[model samples]
Target: MYKATMKIFSGTDTGIPNYSCKTSGPLAAIIEGLPTELSSQFSSLSRMYHYPQISYMSGNLFMSDTVKFPYFYRTVPSELHLCTGIIKLLKFFSWTWVSIIAADDDSSMRAVQILKDGIEQNGGCIQFIKTFSHSRTIPLEDMVNLYIKTSSANVIILYADKRYTGAIKYMNVLQIPQKVWIITAEWDFLSHYSLGFDDKNNTLTFLKTKKNIPSFYKFVREVNPALFPNDSLTDLWWKDLCTNQCPESIRRSCGSNEISPYFMHCDTIHLGNIYSVYNSVYALAHALHNVVISDSANTTMWSGESQKFLDFLPWKLHHYLKNLHFTNALGEEMRFDENGDLSIGYDIINTVFLPDGTQRNEIVGSFNPYAPLGQDFTINEKAIVWDSEFTQIPPKSKCSPSCLPGFRKLTREREPLCCYDCIPCPEGEVSNQTDMDTCMKCPEDQWPNQKRDACIPKVVIFLSYEEPLGIALTLIYILLFLINAVILGIFIIYQHTPIVKANNRSLSYILLISLMLCFLCSLIFIGRPGKVTCLFRQTVFGITFSISLASVLAKTVTVVIAFHATKPGNKLRKWMDSRFSYFIVLSCSFLQAVFCLFWLFTAPPFPFHNMQSETGTILIECNEGSLIAFYCVLGYLGFLAGISFIVAFLARNLPDSFNEAKYITFSMLVFCSVWVSFIPTYLSTRGKYTVAVETFAILASSAGLLGCMFFPKCYIILLRPDRNIKKFLTKNSK
Candidate 1:
């Protein structure tokens, strides 16, 4: 074809062999696979002759400039689009670490540069790039070794034509299994040349053509040696088939005496590059049709029977070609952009390997540059056949697996963002999904689950009656209350007895009633905490214990005065009256009531839900509104107990019959000991335990007063009737 075009331009049959300088009549040329140097040469010639040249497969980036190649155009997309497509392919598969193999030429170098910039801009890294030439000095083995040594890239992109670098031959020899090879449109997998070493599962080819062009396939199938009798290539194809043993079916089908079924099957046909040629031809025909219509409607730029009109007609056709728009037989839009390059789409072909070792190309995906962002790449992953080594799972080409729930991603130091480590969510925070960059904190009423992946309602806790500790404390309070009631009953029954009359029997009655109230107050602490219980529990307990302590103090004072009044000092007898004892108990108990009243009116305790102190639990407890006020009530009670203890200790040796000062001193000692330890334990505990500690202290102190003060007296009064007599008590008091 090249020779024929050159012969026409040279005017060889017109007796002007050197008339190439006056070349004309050719309207335009659709050259396929023209080398950069040859295209440059033809571009210069086309400009001089005002003839337009449209290329079908020339991917040189330099041809994009209209100022430099005014008469040159291409139906195929430039290398820029191809580089962009390659980058998108790499990103889709997350193959950031990739190696490049390009032909040693200007076009391939520019393509590599574009690819490198694209990859780097998208947060991807290139491991290495190796250039190969037609020369044998750099052996294929050496290239393979370099690729293996310098790169851990699983994906290798090959960007060279078959003629320049024997890539298929070298690749077959290397037999690099488990590696994905990205092949450019410049070469195809020829079945005969594959040498049975081409692993289809490992190869992915990018083509600038649509799949299933039925018209083109029909054209290829109809071709035969009989129809093109003058074509020697077709005759050679027939002769080759005859040399081998032909199948009977193929011989009958092809109307030949001998032909193989393999030849007739037409399984080796590759239509990718050929489809581009088909589109290019249709594009030129559409542009010529428009040009002819324009010429017929306007003034003709020609004279009668003159070849001068042909010289200028090709230049006029350039304008029509520039504005051409049409749809091809395959129903694809064929148009060129401002740079005379077609907007092309690429089909991602997955090479499927059958169990029998035969292979075929399957269109599993496509990439359209004109699509919206993030939607340009579409892939049918289920249709893809991966390498045998990966089995059913897709090969992992990531730096790390996805971060699971309850974990977040931490980028590796000095590494790309894609390379990251997974870190668990902190204590109070949670991440409910995979690959979270940061974890979130749960709400106040909720807490993180055990896995820290979700928020759950916190458990409500209180000193409930159902708990063993609360039940035991309740039983103890009841028993002590009954015991105090029995003691009060015995004292009342023996009101007129000398043993009971000797002591301050009125103060004893008041003290027993107050102690019983103290036992009942502990019941308030054992049930579910509520607003009313929280407000009254502490106030009632403080006031009742204070009254009981005041009574004890009054009794101690009476014993001291009674002992001293019996001496020679006659004036002390007036101060020993029961009225003075009543005055002491009333005033002391009145002071405590005032303090408790102030606490209730000012800063009273209330039911509080404590969520922060302990995790996974909400402590339903009383919040002591004012710690100072609460302590003051306890301090006043202790002061009364202290006074009673001192007075009882001093008057313990008094000679009065039935002297109660010794028992009072021991009872105060036990009460002071139990309450003193309560402070630190109450402050140290939290949740239900805090309430438990206070309740235990109350029970212990109340029991101490009941056991020490009343138990001995009851023993003498009930069982030892002789010791309950006036003479026996007087002897013991001495």
Candidate 2:
């Protein structure tokens, strides 16, 4: 250690008057090679003199501690970022089921816990983690074949130094022929290697990003003893001597791996990681320039006095190295991070072994931990070539298959989250994407499609005049209306006849007009239910039917009064006037009109969309704002019909000639039966059929009243006019 230190620096030499000491001893140390056991020793020794020691290769994980090695820096990134890059790479290919085979050495063992936590945290399963003994060939072969060769894990992450070729020397993953391996640059196959056919295929390597150092390849190819006979590197490769034993005038050319060191000529060689050492020289040069260069013409570093030469002091050189930044010949930024490491990432190489024993490292992807989230890791999967040992291209390494759309993932018991089963989505819900845990529900007015992956709009429907049901009901209502009109005409033409004069003739005319209005009210229920129609339809039905029933009650009362007044000395004669019967009709009809007005002003019906009443359709119907008010209106009409029926039935056997009480009773019975059944039928029906039922009730009851009360009178006036005189009337009145 002391001899090496003396060759690197002269601690006591300050170059006061002697210029030969200017370029000697430790201004700074450029430590090269991989991170090894000696790096810590060198780092500790370098820190004693306070010299800045910088390395270009990613080194020991423990070297990153500032307290232990504060002056240590590297151009390559730390080993911690390599673990992160491996995690991102595994996720990119969905290789969730994998194995970790590392060397039983400090460098590989340091990353075991980090890799375990990363793999498990991301829903991945680790079949096993084994540290193979590279020192014992027998144990190494058994452990590799026992745990990895027979296991189901297809992808193996091999972590070790490139110099240690233990388990992966033959790609012996659990002895599995179809295994894929992802090895680090420390196990670099980019250099010279003689492997079994198909051994390099299905293998990937994380190589440090490299740029062509100008003239580096040319210098390696053209290097000879004539160019630099004093340098040890050129002297070892080139020899131009004729030995006395073999007469070396018979020229000999030698390859890199030849056993004999003596050679007349040299072949080209691969320069691995030489670029990093070249960058190391540039780092030292830039640090010295800051201390040497001057902005002013007369203030150059050479012109400074001895006191200003303090910049060359060991500790003083560290300040410039700590904050050094520059661009290299390839236009790549070169700088050290706060932890004294370059923040460079890795390039993914798809190692391809050709048929003729040649090899190639195809750069198919990159992993940059310092990059933004989505752009950090990327791979061109199609560019990867598979090994002949595998039966498929881009081999699968998953615990379970993916769940298809319209299905949800159901995790298996006592298994990792990656192992799961797929279950179909429930009714009225959908899963539009694969691997969803929960399903979504459609809106109120929509329904799920057949695949349950989408929602479709519902069909909107109403009671329209264009449908078959509406057409038939329309023709029936209009025909009944015409029949009523024909009866009213017959009554007008037979105004002077005795049959027409019976049963309170004016009450008959009022009842006929109101019945016509009831028929027209049914038309309101047949068309598309709108705000104006829905508001007034039920009210109109209530008022018009009330008047018709009220007129019937008046006729029954008038017949009873006419009979009672015929008794001698009966006081009912005063109450038997036609005005008294008109008063009863007016008072009963007015009460119904008042109730209808109260209902309209309080809680009126309105058009509503009944979505729940049907599936995949919207039923446009009237919504009774208040159920109590709706029932009250029907009850009032029922009350009038009930009273009218009782009064007419009691007076059915009164003077048959002038009494139309029996016919009035039958009409009231029909009207009462039609509306009483309408309540349950209308409530139970759905869609446009409900409106049809109510319209049918209106037309049926109005036709009953018109046919029963007026059709017989037309028959008597037209078919038997001989009995129309007062003498015939007196005979019929008995």
Which candidate leads the pack in lDDT?
A: 1
lDDT digits (tens) for residues 31-120 of candidate 1:
555765567666766576666787766778878888988878776667777788888878777676777888888878888899989988
For residue 1, give model 1's deviation from the true position in Å. 17
Q: Per-residue alpha-carbon lDDT of model 2 for 1-734, expressed as tens digits? A: 54455445554434222222444333545555545456667787678767788776655677888789888887766777778888888887778899887878776788767887898887688888887665656766776658776767789898876555644555444235788888876654554332233444777878776656787555544545465547665555444222222223332344444323453222112325656776787887887676455322455445445444654455666777788898888777777777777667778888776778766668899887677989888889899988777866778787777777778888899887777898888876778887777788878888778788777876788878898988888888788888888888888888777787866678888988998898888889977789999988888898898888888888888888887888999999999888898898889888888877887888889999887888768888899888888888788888988988998899888765545888989999998899889989988998888888988888888888898888777877888777666666555553
For all predicted structures, in order, the TM-scores are 0.77, 0.78
- Runs in model 1 lying further than 4 Å from the true structure: 1-23, 26-55, 58-143, 146-165, 171-174, 182-187, 190-196, 218-269, 284-325, 334-343, 355-357, 372-376, 399-458, 495-503, 565-606, 726-732
User: For model 2, what is the alpha-carbon lDDT of residue 508?
Assistant: 85
Ten-residue region with minimum lDDT total, candidate 1: 243-252
TM-score of 2: 0.78
